[model samples]
Target: MAAYHARSNSFPSRQHPLIPEFDEQLCRLRSSEAASSSSASLSGKLSGLQDLHDCVDKLLLLPLNQQALSNQKNEKWVDELLDGSLRLLDMCNTAKDALQQTKESTQELQSIIRRRRGGESSLSSELKKFLNSRKAVKKALHKAMESKCAFSLLNRDQEVVSMLREVQSITLSVFESMFFFISGPKSSSWSLVSKLMNSKTVSCEKVNESNEFASADAALNLLISHKMKNSDSTVEENAQKQLQELEMCIQDLEEGVESLYRRLIKIRVSLLNNLNH
Candidate 1:
């Protein structure tokens, strides 16, 4: 009985030692798993922080790029506007100069017409002299026409006709240009005066057209003088109206440009506020 009791106690002591060692081994395994989990979490957190930093860097660069692009566009727009303004100024100056030149020409033409009216040469005597000279010229022309020298006569006649036509065209063009400047209703208040002058000239044309040949020539001369006088008066009125209209248009344009500039400035300010937010 004593030996059996001792054996039992020894068995208990050995089992107790094994239980402590097994418990220590289990603790070590649990600690290793916890350490591995912590390392994985730390790695994940570091990776996440790196991704956030990269995203932040990209986000910061995006606004800078947009700002740079916007600045370039604004500079280009400003340059274009400056160029356009200079061109407009040049055009305005040119128009002003043209207006002055037109005024001066109209004045000179009026003086010439007045001088022509004051002359008292009888139309009958002038017509008679002209007819006599024309008769001689006609005889000479007929002689040339009768000649067998075809090339020479043809060339001479063509040259004279061309010269006369050129002179007439040049005179007509000058008269038309003057009329446009002086009598234009779009530019000046003189349109009323011009219209009144036109009525008088048209009446003179009717009178000349109804007269007998000899008296008709005299009437035609008188009609021409009246027409020239009317034309000069018309031109002066038109030019003034045009100038006034141009000035008004310029004023409106300037106001519009200023409004646009103010609106653009406001838009830029708004954009800056949004970027800051």
Candidate 2:
């Protein structure tokens, strides 16, 4: 919420016992985000963020850290941290909304497939509906991405504030990455199928295989454009498989984000309570 400035070298109290563990968790998360573009890895990043925030909350509970943060002279940084928390909450809630939308659409299509509701024409119609729902999700994700969260630099002596600001910065980065993952790469002239297949040199095997949503999209597109037969059991099976994978991924991400959201709430309450005291 404060004017964003580059504070690249900032670190928490050097002697704080929890700082090492916190740093390790943060580094692991950054490494995980950089090492892969898979939904599985993003789920891992969410877990690592939870651990990192737990450390932050623990630090907040320390007598010396509380004393520092609660000082009236530190009011500027306190306001910044509080505002940062709200931004994080907004980002988390947006991600949850997108994920929920995706989950519902996926379930609807899956149900139709399981019921063997109709012939190929009917299935194609439902698949088109599903794809259209995905476009809405992507639009929401794109707009959410535009709301940037920036962390501000604090005085060198404000160790606790510096540490929290760093946490906010990294958390913002991870959320942006998650939004991109959920949105499943922007559509272009290349087409989702081509992007999944030949867009990235290091892409995982199969079409957009690393991204559950993209893979599902590719599968559905094939069904629609190819006009596959209703009697083709493999066609239905593959579509079902992709949808199942997406459902599993959605559940994992939903749980992770919900847990992380709770952690953020707890941290915010702790900060408020400490300020009051």
Candidate 3:
């Protein structure tokens, strides 16, 4: 999709010339996401979003852009932009909570595994609890994704308003992917464990390994199942490895999401300032 609406000939040449570069960054993010699911892919996507928002912040700060957005006829689009910002904030917050919950649970499980003296009974009990926590997190993420807002088609001639809409569009798309990776890919018929198992090569894991969330879940489930069946101790080692990897992934995402949350707030504040001005 076109990342930003092209300005008409009548608009001044100096008015937000970053729009083209913004489009380039947006396209690069989408392409990178489609090509890989490595640890670096998620970080790259978040970094790309930060850059895109920086461009948007600059656009919002432009005098002509603010003036055009504040025009009486463009009030509806302005309200829509504000509303869109809120939706983005809500989704970002949901993602943060889910990641934090998963991180804590994963860490606890890892600690339990490390202390093999805790005995098989204790390990099994903690495994079940960890799986249960993951199930709840998945349900919450699914609900948030389901309840995400759809952008309304607003009729507006102003380039500034169109850029705002594009920002919302791209922001939502990136978050949807991040949430899917964090929560595992969507499936209607598959149960929590089954879905993650089956989704290894789906949207988020086509080219490479499953996302850390899904991979960790699958490994844990497999380890628990083997334990129930009196399997080898090797499985426990692998499961611990997966949990450690997942913890690292969560840390990177936690930092990235926090930064992006601040960026979203900045964007929203700029929009509100325009409305107030």
Candidate 4:
């Protein structure tokens, strides 16, 4: 759970878009009662979405987590999860691209206004500041993109739409499985998991075929280890092995985020430099 926490400062990441929105609302809320009420309502709605995202993250990791308990029984299901996660990773980039495009559109709109103003009026200075802010935002986004390694499977932003559809297909399949497996009449024991599964926020439609960040081979090895022994020590050893691989992937994801954050920090620096000048 703690592993999934995002950085405090940066653009809204795909993983926790609400957090940034919440923060922005908080800043506005500081100035007005109306803003406070609006933000509070928004926060309420965001919480549900946050719950869904977090649950999806955990479900994505269930195969590895279950290995820790010596109960790896689902090779086929685990493989499916792996495939979904791979597609998810590829799709996550799409989410980021969408965000960038949205920001770019906003900047372009501001640029048009800035051009029309042409620095003739009192508000021209403010318009110039807005333009500078937009430039800085673009720079930060570009720097982040430059610093992070591209997704190995897919690199083009033009593919984001199709890739997103693919991800949604996988998500729906996962939700369908969870709906039946955890929420089925016979599976009352998994009620909590069932509830999360039922969350309206997470679902994907059918894609031809797709997949996750997890390797099928590693998952298979873990399954073998669990079947070979029920002893605590054996499970512990295998769990540790799975942990090592999971951590590396987690770190890679973190690095991608860290780049965006670091670039944002530089944007602040650049902003200050411009103000001083």
Using all chains and alpha carbons, the TM-scores for the candidates as numbered come to 0.23, 0.86, 0.86, 0.25
Better of 1 and 4 by TM-score: 4
lDDT of 3 at 271: 85
Ranking by TM-score: 3, 2, 4, 1
Write candidate 1's Cα lDDT for 1-277 as tens digits.
0011122211223243433342343333323332322222322322332332232223223443234324543344323333333333333233333334433433443344345543534422432443343234334333332431211111122221222122222222222222232222231222333443456443333332211212222332332343455335443333333323333432433343333334333333433443344
Model 3 worst lDDT run, 10 consecutive residues: 199-208
Summarize candidate 2's per-residue lDDT along 201-255 as a digit string, tens digits.
3222454444888878877775565544446565467678888989999999999
Model 1 ranges with Cα > 4 A deviation: 1-72, 117-277
**Which ranges in model 3 have alpha carbons more than 4 Å from their true place?**
3-5, 9-17, 36-38, 186-209, 226-231
**Candidate 3 C-alpha lDDT tens digits along 1-277:** 5554556432335444676777788778667756656566778788889998998888677677788777787788899889999999999999899999999999989888888656877788898999889889889988998998799876546667776787788778878878778777643213434554454322223212466777777667766664234455555666787788889999999898899999999999988888887
lDDT top scorer: 2
Per-residue lDDT over 1-277 for candidate 4, one digit per residue giving the tens place of the 0 to 100 score: 1121333211223454444443344333223322222222333323322333443333223332234222233233333334444444333353245334434433443344345454334333433443344345445444433443322232222121122223334333322222221112322223322332344421222110111112211222232332333332432233334334433433433344334334323323422332233
Clashes of each: 9, 0, 0, 14
lDDT of every model, 2 decimals: 0.31, 0.78, 0.76, 0.32
Q: Lowest summed lDDT over 10 consecutive residues: which window, candidate 2?
A: 1-10
TM value for model 4: 0.25
Tell me model 1's lDDT, rounded to 2 decimals.
0.31
Ranking of models by lDDT? 2, 3, 4, 1
